[model samples]
Target: MSQAWLRQPERGSVGLLRFAAWLAHHAGRNATRLLLYPITVYYILTSPAGRGASRDYLARVLAEPPGWRQIFRHFFCFAQTILDRVLLLAGRTDGFELAVFDRDGLLERARRGQGCLLLGAHLGSFDMLRLLAVEQAGLKLKILMRPDHNQMITSLLAALNPAVAATLQPIAGPADMLRLRELLAAGYVVGLLADRATPEDRLVTVDFLGGQAALPATPIQLASRLGVPVFTCVGLYLGGRRYEAHFDLLAEQIVIPRSAAMDATRLWVERYAAQLARYLKLAPYNWFNFYLFWQA
Candidate 1:
């Protein structure tokens, strides 16, 4: 993949994140949460891009443009999730209440020594599920992330706990692709976020949140190539300290015969998009793609 992803700047500063981390650890989670009201207001007042994105997304799903309060709540929720990442990564999960709904027994019945791909989105904290796999089951889960997609937040999160950040993998050229294949063969679950497209990635547009939107087709390619089931995982914040995670089996298998490969991939991408849209409806504020997602 091209390094265009590196050029896409993130919203926050590393210095501010580091300061938040210091406050969370030294002053405690509750003590530092007093900062979110101001932080949310700052973003609402200063960041038009993110605020517009939030309102645009909300309007599509809510069937009307969102009020300032609803938009403010969106930013505040995102802020809370980021703050909780510090605690979750630092092994302070006792303060959180997690409910995992694996209706298809995806997480519960995961093969102990086999590898599969976990398809997640930018909706909620994908890091939340990492704690479950890393601390509870000890599964060999490696996340596939762009090299510099979230440079500021990534660096500060890594500073808080280096172990979790160590699992991020890149799937750019042939060499990295070979490594990912080898990891799967070696019984490692490779997790990838399939919600957005990188510049080098081919876009697959489908109906999402009552509008047509483009999402990356990489996960379909990987699941078919590796001959593994793709499981859909969502971590939703219900408010305060409660978060619900659902790990449902999305595709049993994806077989793209050479004669009809393009058609097959589009069909599969549409299926994934429909499922993602349903999850978005369930948790409106949890949609965290703070950008013009439906736009180019």
Candidate 2:
């Protein structure tokens, strides 16, 4: 909501990224992960804004104020997720362990050719969700996102897996909406991250992690407009190579009357924020929003 995150310049260059990707492919994940320590320390020493944001967030969720070591670990955790994205995109998930908890909901929906919305956050590895759902389970998924923020990384990752890149639906233009509708009608799951709000997004303040935070209302509004099933989903990293993909039905269909659209959207966003807080508490370091969250 601050829009400050959007202003933060991306770190690293195409060469560094290409090298990392090359190292991941050549040296293997375990060996490549040895590089995370120096990378984490470098970022910790250079990025004051991200470090301060981590400390502020930890103070709210953690029992005590976080120390420098904890902040370093936070950066390390983020680094791990990014590294895993490379392996996942490259179809090298044999070493990773994934525990999926969808019950009969999402799988049943997909089996019946009923597409739904998977509302996620920036808390963990979304690429893991894509790996399990699309690759393993054979579900069609379209990720709705704005890839222009980190164009360099986006382009590099797109190069790693062009198939995944093809599934990306940028959040722009009237034509995308029509395409999304067509995809959903054809039983393609559309995923969107609901946590970060841009300047143009409608903001809804909700109680989160002992403080009030502003989240975008657009995802809920979109669900309401589409009148489709909405599911709250997150892929949480549980240390090492373990991950948990959790999915719970948020709504069968969101209906907002024009009379009380504001109130209705607020309620939906509150529910969503509550779900996000629940998962974030489970893996605090998995949260990657490196900005003054509460201020926004």
Task: Give the C-alpha lDDT of model 2.
Answer: 0.83
Per-residue lDDT for 24-51 in model 1, tens only? 8898889889987897788789877778
Model 2 segments more than 4 A misplaced: 12-19
TM-score result, candidate 2: 0.94
- Residues 1-296, candidate 2: write the lDDT tens digits: 35668877766334445766898999988888898788778888888989999998888877778999889888888888888888888888887899988736987898899989999888888889888754578788889987677567768878999988877888776677888788888998899999888877888887788788888888899888887799988888888999999998999999999999989998999898888888878888888888888864
In model 1, how many backbone clashes occur? Answer: 0
Residue 166 error, candidate 1, Å: 2.3
For each candidate in turn, the TM-score is 0.91, 0.94
lDDT of each: 0.76, 0.83
Where does the lowest 10-residue lDDT sum fall in candidate 2? 11-20
Residue 234's lDDT in candidate 2 = 89
Error of 2 at 41 (Å): 0.6
